[model samples]
Target: MATLDLTQENFESTVLENDFVIVDFWAPWCGPCRAFAPIYDQVSENHLDIIFAKVNTEAEQAIAGSFQIRSIPTLMVFREKVIIYSQPGSLPASALEDLIVKVRELDMAQVHKEIAEEQAGHA
Candidate 1:
């Protein structure tokens, strides 16, 4: 299946509804983003069980800005509506697959609780 195109309009519904989502924040003019497109597409095609969505930084500035994407081709992995991995580089196909595997194995409840405790401590 083709990767889903996420916009500021549908971003919330799509990402929040899916149990596992991998979103790529990219721009058409970015060289690295251009290079990473095919790799991400292949992953999307190979992994039908997960949702792959693209956020165009230029078009959906508000959504991209909220995510604080300083670089193009930033990838964010979300499981059960909580962010698990936020990496700011283009990863090769193998590395992307490995990341997916690791995320699938994550103990999300514990991870989220730890993040909450860290946030509370900082406050």
Candidate 2:
């Protein structure tokens, strides 16, 4: 699947509707972002079931700000409408593939249970 162009207009709907989404926050002006674009696109092509998306920081400032993106080339992976991974940096193809595998293997029920327990403890 090709990467979707993400914007504030469709951000909520996309995130709410997709079971799995991987968003790349980037801008053309950033050297690292440019270098990572192809890698991200290649990874997207291999994962047809996942929604691979891109948020052009230069264009979608609001959406980028909403996510508190402090750096370009940040990758965020969402599964079951929940964020499973979010971090700044460009990952190599192997690392990206490893991340996808880990995300797929995650037990959401256990993750949610852990989140709930942590929240309950805080409260």
Candidate 3:
């Protein structure tokens, strides 16, 4: 599937409704972000089950700030409405593909249990 251009209006719903989502936080003027776009797009095409979305940091400053995105080309992966991976920098196609594999292999029940335990501990 083609990548989706995310805005404040649809971002929350997209992440919440999708089982797996990969968000690329980027800006047009950043060289690395420009360089990573095609790589992200290529990877997106190969993963039809995952939602590949892009948030333009320049245009969506509120969303970017909420995530504390200090750099362009920040990649975030959300699984079952929980953020599983977030990092800065542009990844090569192979690394991105590997990340997808890892995310897919994750046992979400375990992850949710951990999250609940952590929340309980905090409480």
Top model by lDDT, which number? 3
Candidate with more favorable, higher lDDT: 1 or 3 = 3
Write model 2 residue lDDT over 1-123, tens digit each, in one string: 789999888988999999899999999899999999999999888999999999999999998898999998999999888899999999999999999999999999999899899999999
Error of 3 at 29 (Å): 0.4
Per residue, candidate 3 scores C-alpha lDDT tens digits across 48-67 of: 99999999999999999999
Deviating ranges (above 4 Å) for candidate 3: none
lDDT per model vs. reference: 0.92, 0.94, 0.97
Ranking by lDDT: 3, 2, 1
Residue pairs whose backbone atoms clash in candidate 3: none
At residue 25, give the lDDT of candidate 1.
Answer: 94
**Cα-lDDT of candidate 1:** 0.92
For candidate 1, write residues 1-69 as lDDT tens digits.
Answer: 798999978999987889999999999999999999999999888889999999999999999889899
Scored by lDDT, model 2 comes in at: 0.94
So what's the TM-score on candidate 3? 0.99
After best superposition, candidate 1 residue 56: deviation in angstroms? 0.6
Question: How does each model score on TM-score?
Answer: 0.91, 0.94, 0.99
